[model samples]
Target: MKRIFIILSLILVSAAAVSLNSCKARDKNVIRIGLNAPITGDIPKVGEGAKFAAQLWLEDIKKAGGIEVGGKKYPVELIIEDNETKAESAVKASTKLITQDDVMIIIGPFASKQAVPAGGVANNYKTPMVAPWSTNPDTTKNRPYVFRACFLDPFQGPVVANFIKDEFKFKKAAVLFDVASDYPKGLAEFFKLAWEKNNGPGSVVAYESFTTNDKDFSSQLTKIIKSGAQILFVPQYYNEVALIVKQAKELGWKGTIAGSDSWGSAETVKLCGSDCFGKFFSTHYAAAGAKGDTKEFIERYNKKYGYVPDDVSALTWDSLNITKKAIESTGGLTGDIKKDRTAVRDALAKIKKFKGITGEMTYTDSGDPQKCAVIVKINNKGEFEFYKSVCP
Candidate 1:
C-alpha cells in the first residue's frame, strides 16, 4: 500500500513538472516574426540596410512597450535567417523559420528571386508574409497569405513609360532585358504594353533579350542603336545596368537611359560615374526633395546608418508597421495558429489608408499596393536627385 501511495505522489509530481516546464517554454507576451533576408551574398548592402532599418523600428516598438494587440501589447521577437541571395537558400531559410522557429509571420527576402521561393514556403504552411522591396507580381499573385509593401512592377512599369513619354516627349523606346530573370522580363513586358497602348502600337523601336551573367551587351546595344530608339530602357539590376551603360558608351550610342527601381542604387553611381548623368529610374523616395514623413525617415535613417535610406530600407521599415497594424486589427492569434493566420490575411486584405513612411498605401484584393513612384536622376554628385513624383 505504501509503494502504491509513493507511485501516485511521483506521478503527480511529474505531471506538475511537465505543466510548469511547458508554461515556461512560452512567454505568452512575445510574438515571433521571422525575417528572411539575403544577409550574406552579392548584394548584402540591401539586406544590411533592411536589417538596420528594422532594428530601428524594433527599438522604437520596444521602448513603446511593444505593439498593441486586442487592447494589450506583446513584445515582438525577430528570428532572422539569411537567404544568401539564392532561391534554394531562401527556401531552406524560410522552411526553418516556419517549422523550427515557429514564427507567426515573416518579413523580407528583398528581391523577387528570394521572395518567390520564400513566398512559396509561406503559402505551403499558411504563414502570412510581406515582401518589402520585391515588385514582381508572382510573389503575391495567387498567394492570398502573401502581400507586399511596395508597388508592383505592373504599376511601376507604366509609371516609368508614361513619365518618359510625358516629361521627355520621346516616343521611341527600346527594351533590353535579362531574359533569364523574371523581374526585368516582367517589367519589360509591362512597359511594352503600356508604352504601345498609350503612345501607339510599335512605339517601342527595339526589343532585345540577354541571358544572365552576360558581360557583353554590345550585340544587344547594336540592335537598339540600329533600331533608332531615342530612349534605352534596360530593366536590370544596378550591376548589369552599369555594365550596359558602359558598353553603350563604348558603342557610341549616346541616348537617354531609363530603367525601373532595380537601377536605383548608390553602387550604380559608383560603377557608372559620369556615364550615368541625366539618367533616371522610377523608385520610392529620394533624399534631396523629401518631405513630411519621408523627410523625417531620411533624416533619422541617415543619423542611424551614416547614409541616406534607399527603397529597400524605406519599404522594409513600412512593411513592419503594416504587419503590426494588421496584427492589431486582427487582435493577433487566439492560440489557434491556422485561424489566426487567416485572420491576419483578412486584416491585410482590408488594410486601406495605411499611412506608411514610404507613402500612403491601399492594398487591393489582388495584394497589389496602390502607391506612387518617384523618379530620381543620378546627379554628377552621384546622389539621387528628385526629378518627379508620378501618382496613380
Candidate 2:
C-alpha cells in the first residue's frame, strides 16, 4: 500500500511539471506586433512596400526561430490594419490593435497626417509606436509614447534646401506643395526659409499649393515655367509628384524638379516614365548598390520577397529592428504594461549613434532620429541613383 501511494504521488508530480513547462513555453514564445498603414487608397504602394518589408523581417525572424527576449526565444506575429489613407480610419485601426489585438508595439500609417491620429491612439493606450516614414514634427511632438525612425521634416527640408543652394548651385527657385499634407506643407515652409537664409531674400520666384487629390498640374506648372525659376521644389508624395512631373514635362517646364523623401517609391518611375528622369529628391536610404547593413538588407529582401527593397521598406525594417532593440534592452515585457512601455520609451529616447540599414539613427528628446540624408536623382533609366550624403 505504501509503495502504491508513493507511485501515485510521483505521477501527480510529473503531470504538474509538464503543465508548468507548457505554461512557461507559451509565455516565452510569442510576441505580437501591430502594423497600421494605408494599404489601400491613392498612395497604397507606399504602405504596401512598408508592409511587405515588415512581413519579410518577421518571416526571417521566424526562420531563425524568432528573437531572443529576456533569455527566451519568441516568434513574432504581425497584425496588420489598413487605414485606407484616412485619419479617422487610422485612429479606428489603431484602437483595434491596442484594445482587441493587444499589441504592445505598433508601426505605421506612413503619411504624417495619418500618423498624427494613429499615434494619438497609441499614446492613449500607453503603447509604444514607431513611425517608419512620417516626417512631420507634430507626429512625435509632445507624444512621449510616439517615436519615429525617420528624420523630421524640419531637418530634411533644410538639408534639401541647402543641397540645392550649395551642390546644385541654384539661386532662384519655385515651390509647389500639397496643401492638405502636413508633411509637404511644413517641409515647403522650412525649405523656403532655408533657401532664403542661404541665398538672398526673394529667392523663391513662385510659391504654389495644390490639393492632394489634384491630378492636372498644368496650371501650376505653367506658373512655375513663367516665373523664370531655375529649379522647382515639389514637396509631395510619389503619386502626385509623378503626375506633376509628367504634366510639368507636358507643359515644357524644363527646370530641375526637386522634392522631399515622399518621392521615394518604385511607382514614381512607373507612373512618370521618362518624365521623372533626372529629377532629384531627398530620401533616407536606397537598396541599389547599398553597402554594409544596407547591402545585407537588400540581398535578404530580394531573396525573401523576390524584389528589391525601397526607401519605405528600409525605413520600416529599421523601425521594427529598433523596437526590438528597445524591448530587448528593457529586459522584455514582464512588468506592468504602463511601466514596461515607459521603460521601452526611455530606452528608445536614449538611442544614440545606432547604425541602421537606413543610416545612423540618433534619437532626440522628441524621439526623432538625427541621421544622414541621401540625395537621389532619377537617372535616365527611371531608377533612383545615389548622388551624395548630408549628415546632420
Candidate 3:
C-alpha cells in the first residue's frame, strides 16, 4: 500500500511539470507578423507579390531557427488579411492586426490611398508599419509609426520629368493620369510642374485625366497626338499604363513615352507587348545586374517561388529585413515596445548608407529615404534594360 501511494504521487507531479513546460513553450516560441494587402481585388498582383515576399522572409528566418529575442528564440508566424483594394478595408484590416492579433509590426496594403487610411490605424494603435511600395508623400507624413522602403512620388516624379527633359531632350510633353489613383494624380502634377519649371512656359501641351476603370484611351491619345508634343508622360500603374500605351500606338501617335516606378513589373511587357519597346521609366531597383545581397535575394526567391521577383517584392523583403535589424538592435524583446519602437524609428532615420536589395537607403527626418533611382528602358526584345542611375 505504501509503495502504490508513492507511485501515484510521482505520477501526479510529473503531469503537473509537463503542463507547466507546455505553457512556457507556447509563451516563448512565437512572434506574430501581420500583413494587410489587397489579396483579392483589382490590384491583386501587387498585394500577392508583397505577401509572397513577406512569407519568404519568414520562412528564411524560421529555417535559421528563428530570431533571438529576450533570451529566447521565437519562430515568426504571419497573419495576412485581405484589404480588397479599398481604403475602408485597409482601415479595418489594420485595426484587426493591432487589436486582435497583437502583432508587433505590420506590413502594407500596397496602394498609396490604402496606405493613407491604414497608416492612421497604426498611428492610433502606436504600432509600427513598414510600407513596401506606397509612394505618396502623404502616406508617411505626420504618421510617427509609418515608414516605407520605396521612393515617394514627389522624388520619383521630378526625377523622371527631369530625365525626360535632360536626357531625352523632349521640350513639349503631354500628360495622361488616372484621377482615381493618388499615385498617378500626384506624380502627374509633380511631373507637369517640373517640366514647366525646367522648359519655361508652355512646356505642357496636353493634360488629360482618366478614371481607374477606363479601358479606352483613344480620346486622350488623340488630344495628345494633336498637341505636337515630343514626349508623353503616363503616370499610372502597369495595367492602365499598358492599355494607354497600346491605344496610343493604335492611334499612330509615335513619340518618346515615359512612366513612373509603377512600370517596374513583368506584366508591363506582357500587357503592352511590342508597344512598350523604347519606353523609359524610373524605378527603385531591378533584378538584372544585381550583386551582393541583391543577387542572393534573387537566387533564393527564384528557387523558392519558381519565378523572378519584381521591385515591389524586393522592397517587401527589404522592409522585413529592416524591421528585423531594428528589433535586433533593441536587444530583441527585452525593451519596451513603445520605447524600442522610438529607438528603431530613430535608427532607421539615421541610416546614412545601407545597401538594400532596392538600392542604397538613407532616411531623412520625414522618414523618406535618400536613394538613387534606376532608369530602365524597354528594349526591342520586350525586356527592360538598365539605362542609368539618378542620385538625389
lDDT top scorer: 1
> Could you give candidate 1's per-residue lDDT for residues 1-392 as a string of tens digits?
99999999999999999998787454546788888888987678778878888888898898999888888888889888898988889889888887777677899778888898788889889998999989999999899889999888889889989998898888799999988887888999999999998889989989999998899989989989999999998888888888999899889897899988887766778788888888989998787777888888889989977888778888988999888888899965686656777787788888898998878899876567888889989887888998998998
- lDDT (0 to 1) per candidate: 0.86, 0.84, 0.82
* Candidate 3, position 182, lDDT: 86
TM-score of 2: 0.90
Best by TM-score: 1
List the candidate numbers ranked by TM-score, top first: 1, 2, 3
For model 2, the stretches where C-alpha displacement exceeds 4 angstroms are: 1-29
Each model's total of backbone clashes:
0, 0, 0
Worst 10 residues of 1 by lDDT: 21-30
Residue 231, model 3: Cα distance from true site in angstroms = 0.8
Off by over 4 Å in 3: 1-29, 334-347
Clashing pairs in 2: none
Q: For candidate 2, lDDT tens digit of each residue in 1-392?
A: 99999999999999999998676443324677899988998689878888888887887788878777688776778899999988999899999887776676899878888998888888878888999999988888889989998888888878888888887798899999988878889999999888888888999889999887888888888998999998999988777887888788888887788988988888788877888888889999865568998988888877877777789899999999998888788777674555766787888888777889998888866668888899998899777888889887
Question: What C-alpha RMSD separates each model from the true structure?
Answer: 3.2, 6.8, 6.1
